[model samples]
Target chain A: MSLLDIQDLTIEAKQGQGRQAIVDRVSFAVPEQNIVALVGGSGSGKTTTGLAVMRLLSPGLNIVSGRIYFEGNDVVAMPEGELRRYRGKQMAMVFQEPLYAFNPVFRVGCQIEEVLQFHTDLTKGQRQQRVDALLRQVEIKDPGRVARSYPYQLSGGLRQRAMLAQAIAANPKLVIADEPTSNLDVTVQARILTLFKKLRDDLKLTVLIITHDLGLVRSLADQVVVLSSGRVVEEGPAGEVLQHPRHVYTQQLLEAAK
Target chain B: MSKDKHFVPSPGGLRNFRKNPWAVCCLIILGVFYAGAFLADFVSPYSYQNEDRSYSYCPPMEIQFLDEEGRLARPFVYGVTISFDEFHKRNYIIDKAEKYPLKFWMKGDTYQFLGLIPSSRHLFGVDAPGRLMIWGADARGRDLFSRIVYGGRVSLSIGLLGVAISFTIGLLVGGIAGYYGGRIDDVLMRICEMFMMIPGFYLLLALRAMVPADFNSVQVYFSIVVILSFIGWASLARIIRGMCLSIREREFVLAAKVMGLSDFRIIVRHILPHTLSYSIIAIMLSIPGYILAESALSLIGLGIQDPYASWGNLLSEAMGIIQINFSPWILLPGFFIFLAVMCFNVIGDALRDCLDPHFQVDENI
Candidate 1:
C-alpha cells in the first residue's frame, strides 16, 4: 500500500442555500519517503485539501466523498478515538503560523514534551532528552535555553524551526506542512526549506508541503500537483513538469514565479 | 538575536503583581482581615452570641490607666450605669467610682479554636463579667466588636467558597459550550440566559426560602453559599462562554486538537489557559458580589440566622427608624461591608491593569 493515498476526494463548503464544492473529485498520493508539494495560488483549496488528509476540515466544511488511506487504514472512516492515536504518532502536521500554533502560556519545550507524554510511554527524563535532541535537529543553537523560552520570545525563523521540531518529535512517518515557510523572509525561508529536506532524507519522512510559492516547489518537491480553483490542472514528476509544462495555468504559475 | 530587543524579557515572574501598589495594599488588608478572622476565637474577647443583660445599650468602655487614688494602674474600664432616654431606650453612663481592670491572655469563654483546637484563652478580657464592651452593646447586649470579628470569618469565607463553586461551574460549562459549539452551545447558553433573566436577589430569596428554617446556622450559611453560587455562576458562565467563543477558534487550540489530544485535555490544558487572564479578573471582581449577596440575605433575616454573626445580620439591627435613632453603633457592620467590597474592587481593578497583555512591558512594570 502507498504510505498515504487519496482517491476521488470531494469536499464542499455550505454557501447560501447550497453546497459549493471547494475541492472537487481530485486524487493524489504521497509514496513512502518522498516529498509532494500541493502547489496553488490563493483560494485554490490547497490548505483545505491538506487538512482533509487528516480528516481535520473545519466543522462547517464537509468531505462529500473521499477515501484517505494512510498505510492500509482508511483515514476518512476511522473513528475519532483511533484517528487521535493515528495522528500524533503515525502522521503529524505543522502549520504556516508557528507563533499561533503554540500554546502561549507554556514554554516551547513543555509543549513539545506534552506530545511525547500523550503519544509515548517515555519517562520524564527520556522525554526531556528527546525534546532537546529534536530542537537541536531543527538547528537550534542552544536547545536547553530555547526549550524554556516562549514562542513570542523567538524570532520568526526560530519559531518555525521550533514548530518543525514539534511536528517531527514523535518520529512521525508523514508530516503535512501547510504553507510552512510563507511567513518568513527569503533567507530564512531558504534555510527552513533546507531543514525540511535534511529531516526528510534523514528520517525518510513523507512530506506533503502546501504552498503557493512555486520557487520553493522548483527546488524541493519530488512531485508537484497544481491546483486551480479546487481542480488539479497538472500532476507529474517535478523535473518533467517544471521543464516542459503541459498546462497553460502551470505555465503562467511558473512564469509568475520568475 | 535582534528579536531580543523587542521581546524585553520580564525581570521576574511576579514583577507585575508585586509592582502594583494598590494590589499590594489590598492584599495586605485582605490578609489582615482573613488572618484576624481565622484567629477570631483567640483574638475576640467574647463568644459571638454571648449576651450580658446588664450591659445592654452600654457605651463603649473608655480605657484608662488611673486608679481612684491618683496613681497609675493597669488598663481598666469604668462600670456602666444605666439610665433612660426620652424614647424609653436605655442610656448608659460610665461611673468612674468603680473600675474593672483588663486582663490579657486570660481564660474567659470555653469554645473550640478554629473548630479544631479545644482551648479558649482570649486575647484580652475585663476582670469581671459585663464590665467592658469595646464597640458598645447592641440592644441584645452582644459585643459589636466581637461579633464583627467573628462575622468576618463567616462573611469572607462564604464569599471565597461561593466564588470557588461558581468558577468551577463556569469554566466547565463555558468551556464545553464554546469548544463544542452547536446544540450544546444553544442549550447551555439558553440555560444561562434563563439564569440571567431572573433578578439575582429574588432568585436568592426564592431558593433560600425553600430551605428548612430549623437547620442550624452552619447549615444555613452553607445553603446561602450554594444559592449565591447558583445565582452568580450564570453571568460568569455567559462571560466565560463569550471569551471561549473567540478563543476556541485560535490556531493553538486547533493545533492541540490536530495533535490528537482528547477533547477534554485540549479544553483543560490548551484552551483554558487562554481564558485564564480573563477568568482571574472575573473572579476577583465577582467576589464582592458574593460578599454583598451573603450580606443582603443576612440583612433580610433569611441568611446566617440570629446569633450567627455575619456582617449582614449584624447590620440588620439598624433596619428600623427606632433602632437607628437610638443606637447608631448598630450600623457599625456597614463599615466592614464597605471596606471588604472596596478592597476587592480595588484589587481586582489593579490586577486587571497589571495583567493586561496589551500593557507594554517596561522596566518599571
Candidate 2:
C-alpha cells in the first residue's frame, strides 16, 4: 500500500438551492518520502480534498464517500477525538491565504507555540527554542524579531514563510500545502518552492502541494495528479506528466499555461 | 535632555486610552462611585435604615468652619428647630447657639466593612442630638446621605454582575452557532430570536413578577440581577452571532481547526477573544441600562424592596411633583442615578474609540 491512499473520495456542497457533488469519485496515491502535487484549475476541488482528510472542510461542504489511509490507518473512519489527535501531531496543513491563516491577536511565535503546546509536552524554554529553529529552517533571517511580530506586521513573503514554519512546527509525517504559492509573486514563489525542496530532502518529509500553478509542480513535486473540474485526468511521474500529457484536459491546462 | 536614538514609543492599548482624555475623566468618575460603594460604612455616619421621628421633613443643616462669633474654628453644624405651618407642612430654622462640632472616626452604628470585617468606626459625625443632614431627611426621617451611599453598592454592582452573566451566555451560544453552522446555527439562532422577539421591559416584568414578593432583600437583589441578564443577553448574542458569521471564516480559525484543536478550545482561546474585546465595551455601555432597569423596577415598587436602599427605591419617594417641590433634597438619589448612567455612557464611548485596532500604530512593541 502507498503511504497515503485516497480511494474514491466524493465531496458534496449543499447550497440554498440544492445539494451538488463538488468532487466526485476522486482517487490518488502518494508513496512515502515523495512530493505529490494536486494540480488543478480553479473550482477543481483540489483544496477540498486536503480539507476532507483533515476533517477541516468548510461548513457548507461534506465528504459523502471516501477513505483516506495515512500509514495504513483509515482517516475517514477515525473518531472525532482521534481525528483531533491525528491532526497537528501526525499531519499539518499550510493554506494559500497566509494573511487569514493567522490569529490576528497573538504574536507569530505564540501562535506557533500553541501547536507544540497541544501536541507535545515540551517545556516552555524548549518550545521557544523549537520555534526559533523552525523559523530559521524556513529561511527567516531575523527569527527572533519575526517570531515576536504579529501577522499584520509582516509582508506577504515573510507571512508565507511563517506559515510554512507553522506547517512544519510539529515535525509531522505529512505536510499539506494548499495553493501555498498562489498568492506570492514569482520571485517569492521561487524562494518558497526552494524552501519546500530543501525541507523534503533534508527531513525526508512527505509533502502534498495543491495548486493551480503547474509551474510550481515542475520544480518541487516528484509525482503529479492533474485534476479538471473535480476529476483526475492524468497521474504519473511529475516529469512524464508535464513533458508528455495524455488527457485532453491536461493538454488544454498545459497549453493555457504556455 | 539627551535623546536616545533607540527609544521607540510603544503604541499599545493603554497608551491609546491615555490619548483620549474623555475616557480618563469618565474612569475617574466611576472610580468615585466604586470608592463610595467600598467605603459606604465608614463614609455614612448614620445607617441606611436609621430614622429619627423628630427629624422628619427637616431641611439639611449647613456645616460651617466659622463659629457664631466669626472666629475660624472646627467644622460644626447648628441644631435646627422645627415648626408646623398652616398647611401641616413642617419647616426648620437653624439655632445658632446649638453648635455641634463634627467628629471623625467616631464610634457609631455597627456595619460590616466590605460585608466581611465588622467595624463601626464611621468617617465623620456630629455631636449627639444634632443631625448633620447634608442631603436632609425623607418622609420616614431616614438619612438620605446614608441611603444614597448604601444604594450605590447595589445599583452599581448589578450592572457589572448582570452584564457578566449576559455576555458569558452570549459568547458561548453565539460562538457555537457561528462556528458549527447549519442545523446548529438554525436551532440556536431560533432560540436567540425567540428571546429577542418579546418586549424587553415586559419580559423583565414578567420574570420579576414570578419571584415571590416575600423573598428577602438579598434574594430580590439576585433575582433582579438575573432578570436583567436574561433581558440583556439576547440582543448581545444577536450582535455576537453576526460577528461570528464572518469571524469563523478567518484563516486563523481554520488553522486552529486543522491543527486538531477541539471545537471548544477553538471557540474559547481563538474565537471568543475576538468577541471579548468588543464585549468589554459592550458591557460598559450596557451597565447603565441595568442601573436604569433596577431603578424602574424600584420606582414601581417591584424592585429592591422597601427600607433596603438602592438608587431606585430611594427615587420612588420623589415620584410626586408635590414631594419634589417641598423637599428637593430628596432628589439627591436622582442626581446619583444620573451621574452613574452618564459616567458609564462616557466611559463606554471612550473605550470604543480608544481600543480600535487602527487608532495609532507604532513599530515598537
User: Whole-model Cα lDDT per candidate?
Assistant: 0.87, 0.87
On residues A1-258, what C-alpha lDDT tens digit does candidate 1 reach at each position?
A: 469888889999999899999999889888998899999899999999988887889988999898988997899898888989977788889999888899877899999999999998999999999999999999999999889999888888998999989889888999999999889999999999999999999998999999988889888999999999999989999998899999999999989988
Question: Residue B186 of model 2: what lDDT?
Answer: 91
Candidate 1 CAPRI-style tier: acceptable
Computed on C-alpha atoms, the DockQ of candidate 2 is: 0.37
Per-model TM-score versus the true fold = 0.91, 0.89
Clashing pairs in 1: none
Candidate 2 residue spans exceeding 4 A from truth: A13-21, A122-126, A201-203, A247-258, B1-23, B85-88, B353-365
Location of the lowest summed lDDT over 10 successive residues in candidate 2 chain B: B1-10
Give me the runs in candidate 1 sitting further than 4 Å from their true place.
B1-24, B65-73, B81-91, B357-365
Q: DockQ of candidates 1 onward, in order? A: 0.47, 0.37
Candidate 2: residue pairs that collide? A100-B251
Which one is best on DockQ? 1
Residue B147 Cα positional deviation in candidate 2, in Å, after optimal superposition: 1.4
- True-contact fraction per candidate equals 0.64, 0.66
Model 2: per-residue Cα lDDT at residue B280: 79
